[model samples]
Target: MVYPREELYPREVFDPRDVVDPREELDPRGMVDPPKVVDPCNAVDPRGAFDPRSVVDQPKVVDWYNAVDPREGVGSRDVVDPREVFDPRDVVDPREELDPHGKMKVVIGRLQVVFSRAMLFTLGLVFAHSLVDAAVLSILITHLTAEWNEYSLWKAAIVVNVQEGTLAVAHIVFILLSDVWTGPYKMLLCSAAISALGLSLFQVENVVSFYGPLVLVTLSQAGIVVTLRPFFDDQVMSAAGQSTAETQHWTSIVWWKCITLLAAASAAFGLSRINPFGTRSLVSAIIMGSALFWFLLGTKFYSFDEATGSPLRDAAHVMYIAAVTKRNVEYPRTPNQLFQNSSGHVKIPPHVSWLRCLDKAAVVMPQDQEKPGHICTVEQVLGAKSLLKMLPIWMTFLTFSTVSATGSTFFLEEAASIDEDFNFLTFIFWQRLSSFVVTFACGWALEELGRKMKVEQRMILVRMGMGMGCCVACCVAAWINARHWRLVDSMTVSRLVPQYVLLGVMEGLSIEGLDNFFITQVPELTVRYGPAFEECVLGIGKFLTAICIYILTLLWRWFGEDVYSSRLDKYYLMLVVLSSLNLIIYCLVACWYGDWRFPIPAEDDDIETANHNPVDEAVQEILLQHEKDSLPLLEQKAGQDTQTLRSRSFTRPSSPMVAHRRFYSMRS
Candidate 1:
């Protein structure tokens, strides 16, 4: 390996800054040939020198590991083969060297920070809303009779039920309107203002005035629930960052449920004790006002996406196009024969053959040739098809939701009869607590399990488990109700606690599971509005519960006269049988359900395709032409400046020849 005197280190073109001995030389027959030194002034490209013959030449070394120095003026004997000179890869595997466990620790630590921050801000809103809810639902019922002498228990129940029914309708309205209302914060602000006004109006002494405030409060509450739930879910998504979207989405939901639990606990355990209506109203108004203020403070930081047009309209269009095109065109055996939208964004229709009837929307009729984009895109058809597929599952859950509604009504009555000391608020507290603990725990457990299974399978399993819980809860309730009917005096709140706990377990899993399923399964454009849909489902459930209650009221003979005397055990038993049947049906449906065939492409891959796509190029050129047409005056005024700016903005060349030309041109 010893170098000869002449070849070790050549002095020609050698820089003083380089540390090499000029007297030493390298052997001519070493691993590589002697280095050729070129003058910086005479070089064709100063970036690096390469042999002209190297274009078609094989590499000098048999292996990359045995290659000599790539740099100039360092011969083979002076510089050892790179493989001989220490290789870090030889000693350290990157996965082991970098502390793989530390990466997980970092992610978990970041999640904790995001969770804490989101909880701190959102928990305040939760507290404020919970106060308003308790005041409106619980205190107002007793307050109208205790203070104003305006209502009987029957009247109060009727009024409350009416208010809730109105709210449910309003929730559905807002969910449908979400596509038109791009600014959720505007709704948030309006909800707060209306709620504050409603709370303040309650201070009035007149009985006739109550209805005005009641209507405003009910609408405001619905607006807040529809707007804020989705808004907060979006907020958590933002804080979570993109890498862990699924985990963060689930975590955010869990945190939100926990906050609701805290709110209920606050109301049931603390706010219910405040007997004075005016005082309670004032507190609610202040908290609501504070929530509004807090929301406004963070307005600049919030990132809101513009709403795409309504999914309902898209679904409608899909149906219309399919019907119109059905008779004119022959169905293509291969999906590629059908009209595929140039934009990869819209799901290709014919690919999903299961929904063959809907695929008619993708047929390009003569009318479509004359006017492109008038016909429905494949994406619209896919979205509509997905809705059709999920309908059975939604209906099953809708039936299950009836059990939840029973808790607030008959279940509350059962608890009250058991212990007068336990009261309405205490029952709400226990219900909230059970929901919080069970939901948060189950969500966390499922999240861990999700890593091992596909998301689709995990969601189904969670729902099935929830269905089992509901079945158990119904069985318990039926037994308790039977005991109450037979003895009439042995019921206790402590005895009803287990039922609440079980119901909580059922609801927690079902609600979270459903939310997760829809958030991912629904149209990508509507992902941000997922929580609004959840509210709609809940609203429908409550509405159905109202209907059920009304039907029960009609059958007075079997139900006795009042809460204590009513033979509600039969109703409990009925639900048990109904839910058992529903459970069986759900199992069959879950087993049958198939995932959406048109999986949305990843955002990064879509961007890359768009950059290179010929169709995208044409569209971009059209956009650029439009821009030029719109800015003619500006272009004329700053013609030279604009040209110079455009030229400067062109991506710089990376090659040596281009760099050299640019360098000389700049010097000139």
Candidate 2:
């Protein structure tokens, strides 16, 4: 409901006379004198006293006594009599406070402005969605063995390992086919439907029915990650206008993740107590259903990026063109020497010098006279170059992915072998929540440091460092595992908190680093592709982990046959060495790394002035073209009064369209 000015300030309701009188007194001209005074309360008609709907709600109440007269002689009581004042809180409607514009606004104290109702609803759904995901990750295999007696622990490990491999494949397939998905709404609906069907079919008493649904479950989980996550990232980036908003954006994501983990942890614990009904999966299905409903309800309010066809197609085309245009060519003297035009041009970006061979794609050949853009635009070539550049950095994250998969798979298995005397509460408290606590605590400090440094790339580097630290911590935890193989009887799951906490920190920093880096660096046309590419990277990592596990499983003689008789600590020690080596490689890559052309805050002119790269110069040329092309077409002729359109054509191609046109132009 609309708030009324009078209701907000019942004492001094809006008065035309008061407004006029104050201005007249404050006016230095002194052109008028106070004629008379009329009590507005008595003069108002009973039927037309105040139309509350017509008034705007003022956030700040005006104290007329102090505000009306700036002169020191005017005391607090001079302009507004003490008797006329009333408590605004008494008359104000709290509903108006929540929604002044008659639209729902979700507020958690100060965060109301940034976190809209729809966003909060979406985040809630995310939390519930993650409950299902994490529970699957943390509890599914263990549940299969412990409660259902489907298989032995070692066999269960194999089943779980296979499931992760399946999950990675599912993610890769979804990403490749993401172009067909349309938008997040459809994906959410699809995920919910698949999850419901899978969970329902999971109850059936047959191996075919059970494992088949598990595959569907894996697909559904992929849907959630590929769809929901990008949508949220879009929202956060859209809303992050100021530094506070940026911090809040990351903070909200971390908080959502924490809440999701906590919910998942709770669901995992609840699995034991909920009896024969399979309530954990049931609740998960229910949450998925609820999330779908919420997503559908909020669809209208949700924002989507301008769909720029499939990134897969773009990448493929670039590769095809680069391959077709291959030549034993020398580098051009200058970038502009290759493709020079009024509207567009190609550039051999210096940053991409590591792969000088790819630069051949942008090399204009005499064959171009026969087929103009059959090769590709300079930008398209650069886009392809970007993908090549990303591969090395992507591989560095493989070790991290391996570490993460091990933590969830091996650690959960370790928890199962621990003392049965410890209640679920103890395990949940120690194993589940400690990571969140450390991440939440450390995430704030790290983010604050990033803000102080004012370099987002530095934060990315720091985040990777944290990931390396997690590797170290994992190594230590593994050493402890080697030393104390069966401490579960006394200390129980609580002793594993160190490893969990470290992994949690690792996830908070490294995974988020990957996400933020991509979002910030990737061009708008390929922005949607960033998340999918990330999924692909992590998928490869998971696949690598699966391979390692399978190899380890095959060589049971080396790593030991099972958890009880296993020298798992030695395996952990191996990972420690691998991680250390990986860190050294990553550091070297990081040292050699040059950042993509990132958008800087308008205030920071130093980066632009200090060191300009070839890509930046190319982008600047396009921006200048944009400025030139966008000149106003309608203007009054020099001596004529009437407006007339300019002679210039207004059909200039957009950035992506231009690139596409350039590609085909060469073919023609």
Candidate 3:
């Protein structure tokens, strides 16, 4: 429970000029009078201090002491004096010994703490952006199909699918830029500005202008979403200083996201109902502009990761090197024979056999020695292999994403047609709320279970599997609801609740699982691309949904201009079958994944070790000193009360200080 002082307050918070040292603040003689100073050489040997003869006739320190002492009673060993345990060399002053490099490391660590705390501002930005984003997207389809536009349902669906697809592609482009060139903060500012501009353009009446603005909005939103989470994560990890458990840090991220989702849902419910859709767009623009302003206010405190050169480029180099060397070079017989740097700056994992051919990329050829760029490091090759290993698991989630696309499109259409008085916004509100609750609960439960069971690595797969199973259930519920709506004339929007709730639950589970897996499993240098890859996968799923709808319409009358004539129940039935198959495939992939653990980079371990609290070392020194000072007093009294000590019971002290203090008081 006693945390180090550095953990509570970073070193940057204290300045020598601002702090008044007690030694300099007051006269030493006035504070502790000269008369009160004890001279050890001239002092009396107060009874039972060190002289064994003084306590020859006194009772021993405690009765029954011999019962626990190994030398006195139970299996006898050499009688080792407690005083011998205190070694002067063992009690080091951590501050006094630290070199210039160590001092700089301490300063950097404190600065990292200051930067990490700035994630509070990042969370506020997430809430603001997500609020406006959800409000705009929730009403977009309805706005297109309004009386003024008179747009066909198919036309609206195409616009929505196109926006979704654009978002997917934008995620990749923006994330690459953030990682390789611009950095996240600059990317965030640019995206926010573009989003505001796009939202403002929605006021234009020309139909031809719609698609252009929609693409702008989708691209900007993708950049914001892809950049912000990773930015927040960087701060959290730095703030943790590699000292806290990884599960706890991720749990905090999940909980913060749930809060952002809840806020966005509330904003959507309230702001999407602003009568005219143009007014809603204008309101979203104002909110986004305000968020951008608020984000800039924290610019000084925010931590920005320096843009590393592209992982894709490194991957390409690895492949090119492997191909060029294929005919002439042979794979190294041992991993150490490969081209690792003498300095060991990069921590490469043991060579994996999955992509054995790529090992040639790392072979130290005669020419490669002179041109280091011609050969790839083993780390780069393994990073590419890790991505390939994750491919099958990523493919399994496409069906889940396809099923999710229905909530905003077909599900809303179904609700709108059921009853003229039904509040579809309220349905969306409840659905968002359900997902937020499930996400919060699942994150907490999984963290606790993983900590207790020591199975933190496997929990990500379990969460993904649960979400996939829920996707199938969601589709089944949709089919049932659609069938009941067709058979009965009095059905209300309430009939769609089950499917909506299941959709929310599925999202809460699967999305977090995918995010955690990607972030943790990928090489540290390329982690920014993880979430972007997830968004790209979901976008592909939306395209697949569009493709399925197109094929179905071509073969039979599955969809029409409105919800009433469309055989949506059949479409839902098809999703149920596809999702069921996806779930089975996911299980096989999970089994194949087995016990492979992501290797934490060696630098992180060094940081964790170096970040230990110096205050803890100082405290330990004081405790050891106390033990040393008290031992002779106890030894002097031990022989006098040997009979009395045998009859009295003594419980072990909770701490070394307690034991030392108890005997010191006895000597007094």
Candidate 4:
């Protein structure tokens, strides 16, 4: 029978029942064949002829399955068995399909989640705090010597050194308080308020007022710096979920910090041009107050953990117990024999062969088992070891830190002595701007390198070493510049650019590398204290610098009352020698240090397995059930085909399309 045109070739709106099967009208072998079924939805022409060109020249389909609904357009001729179409083995993972770039998309999505309202406000606070810090550092010595005209250059330098020392001490104290008594949120609020008050006090001129406000501002700034990163990290991890990796989280922190520093540098440049140092201080206070208000607005979104016991105290306790415990006590034969709580309250690191002496603390004596407080856990012993191991590496960076402290004190003084009319770039502005630029460049380069290399921990140590090397180079350049200035009658500030640039590069690499090392290498219990310990070391470095200066001034007239006649070239050479020695020591320490970039498998595996989503498990179970249900139907169809084959002569089709048509014909 001749079918109507509408029945032969279905239009876009035609019902499935309206389309006639070609096999019914013509022999299956003689069916009209298109060149290829490129566009399955539009294989036929309006006149019921197979359209090869239309099929071949079709637009690319993004969502092929949804382009034409199977339930609506599929006729008897197009229908295929569900078993053949829905193979579980062929199913693509939704994550792979959705994320074309794999981990890149995931990292980007995590960053998007982490940069919430609370994080943005936190960054705002960082920017404001950094701006205030840069302003204070830039103007403190200048204000003392030039603006106030009361203190000599050496005295002003001493004041700056004292401020650095105070900052270092404050970092440790504030971080301890945050970890043991006050939470980070309260500490941040209090510190910001105190900093604002101190900035306001810059309006006063007396020595008592100057020293008092200097101490207050240094203490408050230290608290803010030591507390902010850890707090920000907590907020990020909470927002991004627990699955986020340490590298991505820390990388994001560095990127945000770079941006904050860049903006702060721009502000410092503006503050440098301001007539009076007090006006700059007042502007900083206003910015800080506004940031404080902004942070308060996002209080609801911040993640706040309760104050816990101090890790430092726990480490000390572990050492005391280990030392007080009988020296004759035998070390545990195996790690399992060590004192671990039955309830699994603490996570113990895998036993290492080194530091076997400390394992005595974890040994359970026959009588001490009943008294719980007498013996320390394996976790605590390992924590003490971790802290002790970091000390050598920490000490190596002291000279680097001392070199950094000079940027605000002697570097500023040197730049001020140069003819400003010859060079517009001031010390504070150039140093900050160069640092921001170098930080951005180095971060980008390192990120790209990290993708190709697996040596993350090694690279951190190398980067730090490179930074120290740069500090040595910076000091050498400073010495040369100083010598040139003394030799020339008219030397411009432009000559100091190389030293400032090198110093910036050094700060970018060493500071960031050191921060990462502290954050990642420290035991989990003491992770919050890492930044504070770094600051403490930095403070000690400042003290060492001060001592060096005092001794040099007393023994030889290296620093005079002002910048003009001082033997700064000699001082820079001394710093160069010290930094070179420290760089060598750092290399030795790096050689002794073990790689900690990859996590301990024993501790992480359970955490990774336990972190699986329940919804994903449920979906997998449902798919398994579907496959089980589908098996019987497939078997039944195979049985029916076998019976049909036995009853009649059977011939296999030459091609897949012919077989598909024949199967449909037999079913019909």
**Ranked candidates, highest TM-score first:** 4, 3, 2, 1
- Kindly report the root-mean-square deviation of model 3 from the true structure over all alpha carbons: 23.9
lDDT of 4 by residue, 435-491 (tens): 666655775466557546856667777778888889999989988888888888877
State the C-alpha lDDT per candidate: 0.55, 0.56, 0.64, 0.64
lDDT of 3 by residue, 1-668 (tens): 65697676568796667765577446533344344334343333445366533432223324333324644555213445455578767786554334221211122322212223365567666776777666777556777776445566666776677678678767888877887789888988999999889888888787887777787888888888777766766555544444434332443445355656666566655775575767878888887888788888777767667775455666666778787755467645433445533223222443345566776776555544334456555556666666666778889978887898888788887877776545566666666777677765886588568768866657778888999999999999899988887888867677788888988788878876776666545555554466667778888888877777777777896887888878889989999999999999999988877556446334421111223344433433333332332111112245552211000111222211111110110000
- Candidate 1 runs further than 4 Å off: 1-111, 115-123, 138-162, 176-178, 203-209, 237-243, 276-279, 306-312, 323-337, 341-356, 371-373, 418-421, 453-459, 555-561, 594-668
Q: Please report the TM-score between candidate 2 and the true structure.
A: 0.68
Against the true structure, what is each candidate's TM-score?
0.67, 0.68, 0.69, 0.70
Evaluate model 4: give its TM-score: 0.70
- What stretches of model 2 exceed 4 Å from their correct place? 1-113, 147-154, 233-255, 258-262, 268-272, 299-301, 305-308, 327-330, 340-347, 366-373, 421-441, 451-456, 486-491, 559-561, 594-668
- List model 2 lDDT by residue over 1-668, tens digit each: 64686676565565565554556566454543333113332232335555534332332125454443566556555666655577665676655444422223244654443444456557766766666665545556566656666565545656676676566556656644544545556666687689767865666666456788888888887776666666665554444334243344544545465666666566656644654435556766777787777777766656655433354454555566566655556654444434431223233442455655665655555554444333344444455565566777788878777776766566766767775433333334344465555445665566567667665466667677777778778777856865586554344566676777677667656655665555444444454555456666766777777677667767764333346776677778878888888888888877666444423212321112233246535543433342223222233348854432111221211211111111110000
Query: How many clashes (backbone atoms < 3 Å, residues ≥3 apart in a chain or on different chains) does model 4 have?
Result: 0
Please report, as a residue range, the 10-residue window in candidate 4 with the lowest summed lDDT.
659-668
> In model 4, which regions exceed 4 Å deviation?
1-114, 241-243, 246-251, 325-337, 341-356, 420-426, 443-453, 594-668
- lDDT string for model 1 (1-668, tens) is 55563366666845666754443345232232234323222322323356443422234454444455578555566766667667876775543323322111124643542343433455566567766875555445455544555554334444555566577658656655654664566776787789988887777778898789888888888777766666665655555454344455445555566666677777776766765667677777887889777767666556555654354656666777677646455653433334444444333432344666776776545444333433444556666776555566777765566666555556665554555445567666766676677655665566656655646444545555575656556666656666665776475567776676677667666765665565445454444344445555555766676566566667653353345556566667767777777887877776665444235444321112223344433443333332322111112244432210010011122211111110110000
